[model samples]
Target: MSTTTSTTTRSPDAIRGRRLGVLLVLCGAIFLEGIDVAMLNVALPSVRADLGLETGVLQWVMSAYVLGYGGFMLLGGRAADLFGRRRMFVGWLTVFLVFSGLGGLATEGWQLIAARFVTGVAAAFMTPAGLSIITTGFEEGPQRDKALLVYSGTAAGGFSIGLVAGGLLASAGWRWVFFAPVGLAALILLGALALVPKEPARPGRSGQKLDLAGGLLVTSAVILLVLGVERAAHAGAAWTAATVGAGLLLLAVFAAVERRAAEPLVRLGILRSGPLVRSGGAGLLFSGGFFGFQFLVVLYLQELRGWSTLETSFAMLVIGIDAVLSPTVVPKLVARFGNGRLIFGGLLVAALAYGLFLPLGADWSYLVMLPGLILLGLAFALVYGPLTIVATEGVAESEQGLAGGLLYTGFQFGAALGLSSVTAVAAAYADPLEGYRAALLVPFAAVLAAAALSLPGLRRRAEQPDAEALPGAGAGAGTEGGTPAGAAAGLEPARG
Candidate 1:
């Protein structure tokens, strides 16, 4: 009788040391990506002054990045799954690093806009790839939650940090903002290649071809949808309707393509799962609704209030501080009250924060806004982790990566789409402040929707067995993911 002994080989990233290294690399990538997203907004006036860009043209510099980031996010997510995650991650980081230099070197307005758009594409890859790594590397539950906090926190915090960094760099010369991130990216890429633990190929699945048709359709649909929302302001009422109609048509086609593809770009069924639908709803609300807040406030501070660029950046630091500590408290909340009451409570809290801003007039002090923004950040902290956990909970282990990517897709695209809609509203109304107030209500409506989506999951959880809380409902022992056993995680286990 011959019995075979099988050896298990793990990628460095799949282990502890490699995981830490990769985490650091991802943090850098996330920070750089986020910084680019916000950096341009902070320094737009400087760019306008330097390149002779008209005031209206300056908005394009910001939108160019958003369009690329939102449009291609899913494609980027697919790329990570198709190619090795590490290969694509390193490649994207390198591109972003290279382009920061290009953006810095831009001598004309169009040149800078083009460079910013390309950087957005590079960011598309880095964001998903980093998330894929985190989701693949960590197990579900508390451990994974910690990493998500860090990952999500970096994005939230980076939004603020970008402004600070942009101010300093812009003062030196607006180009340095581009130059500095490129250097850091190069360093992070090298470290990521060396330290990011790579997961071994799954036994049944390893290689697959790209769904080019699906990618193009999805990307184009997202871009057109976002643009139409923005264009509804001035493109004539009929053009607005047509643009939206066309966007919907492409999106419907993209859905069909995904459903029929041999290796579908998006796993449609997973997206429809109970937890994921709710999580996605929350992501849509927060990412879209909240994203516009900073964009509007930065303008209010710099242009409307006449604060120095650096001083304005310094003021928003409260959000990062609150977000870092907020998520850690979530597990305790879940343990005590369950997800339903808490999530609804959080959303209502966030709505209140945004609503408070509506009443502020031209003479209102920055101090008044600070408290509301802090409350908003705190509300975000409460909902972020639990919602992420719920999003992946109902799926089988093999599908976790796909779901992770999709949920994030909703997150990025929703925010981008939301911001565009709000911007159009503000611009159309011709009273930027009033427009901001009007837009504030949109997120409030969105949170109410998220609360509705999450309610079902919360009720469902009440009926599941305690063992179900364990990895693969306790079938998997000592595995990172909650599967039959021997599975690894994409990110850390869900925290708290």
Candidate 2:
């Protein structure tokens, strides 16, 4: 009898070069996506002027992108899982590049909107695919933690950098905002083709079909919900209420479909995971508050105070501090104080920052807002990175894409709600100062809610072992014997 020699094929984590390359490429792609969003907002007025668009039609340039991004995310995430992640990522990136160029070239309002919508759809697919790659590619330990922190930091930086880039570019021409992303995206695509590893096919996914029924219902629900929120801000109550009701009904239907489908777009059972659910809720509130606050601040600084776009961008740059802090500072903090305390503390700090803004006056000094802005930036550095870790930690490899998608869904919906609700509240008051003050309340309350939601997670942390004591807790250079981050966080190890 001969003994068989078995070969153990190590995961991509074994190679440092490939892992770093993949992370850098993903960060670049995510950064481009973030910049694309913020830059467009900065150029919106210019876009309207250049295209001779009506106020109503101009809104669509922004709304069309949101609708496509939020609506198609679930379908896109599931497609990454079922099809190949690399294939989906590269293909969608190509689409994004092409449409971004189209958007830059478009003379008509409708043509620009169409290009934006398609680009958003492409981002829906590309983002989750990139995130799933990170979740699966890196070994689940400090190494992975470091990568994620960098990822989160880059994303925040993109938004901040985008605003500055937009202001500078818009001065030259509004079209450059769209054209810039094309060049950045093309470079990333070439890098990805070389650097990103091709995800191996899961054993059972080859024969599986997409849950089209679930996709349609969910997409329709999201689109309707977003429309209703925006309509409530601008239109009659009756139509808004009807639209919202229809969206709720479709959401209920989608849940039912998911429960019955052989291969569901979203596995309903995963919603039962407390960490995932709570993290999603907290992220929602956090994002909503941040976006609402930003919108009001921009209006206050630029429109009311007559500050130039460049000045406004510089004022907001303090909020981008997270890009530096996350990769450098947060990992050490996470290893010591834990994610729960940091998230809760961050939320409260952010709330206090917004609270300071509640005392706004027509001739307030920039010095008065400076402290709050710095605090808010610190809060973001503390919160965004760890919240992401919690959201995707417990999930299996196969469903990591779905988990990432759900977290981002909360983010997108929260932003829409926050911006729309605050705008509506502000519109209700005749006095501009009073309207701004009233709008400030929305973010303050939102942060309070986020802080409260984080309390349960602290209890969840107590139930688990010490993060350092757990296997792979802070395994710096060596990979053996330590528990992965998820298991340390009280979640099971991922199954292939």
Q: Which ten residues in a row have the lowest lDDT in candidate 1?
A: 1-10
Model 1 ranges with Cα > 4 A deviation: 1-16, 326-328, 331-342, 394-398, 428-436, 460-496
lDDT of 2 by residue, 73-119 (tens): 87888888778678889999999999999999998988999999999
Please give the CA lDDT of all the candidate structures: 0.69, 0.83
Q: Which residue pairs in model 2 clash with each other?
A: 471-482, 471-483, 472-482, 472-483
Clashes of each: 26, 4
| Collision count of model 1 | 26
lDDT of 1 by residue, 1-496 (tens): 1222221233211335445666777777877777876676678778888889885567677767767877888888778766767777888888888877998999987888888888888888777777766665666445455556666667667777887888888898988878888777878888887777565666555567778899899889887876676545546778877877888999899988887898878767555455566677777777777776766776677777889999988887677663475435665566577656666777778878878877758878878888887888787777765566666553444444455666776777677666666667677677767776676667667766766666675563453423433324344433434342113533333221
lDDT of model 2 at position 87: 87
**Candidate 1 vs. true structure, TM-score:** 0.86
Question: How far in Å is the alpha carbon of 386 misplaced in model 2?
Answer: 0.8
Off by over 4 Å in 2: 1-15, 460-496
* Candidate of highest lDDT: 2
Considering every candidate listed, which one attains the maximal TM-score? 2
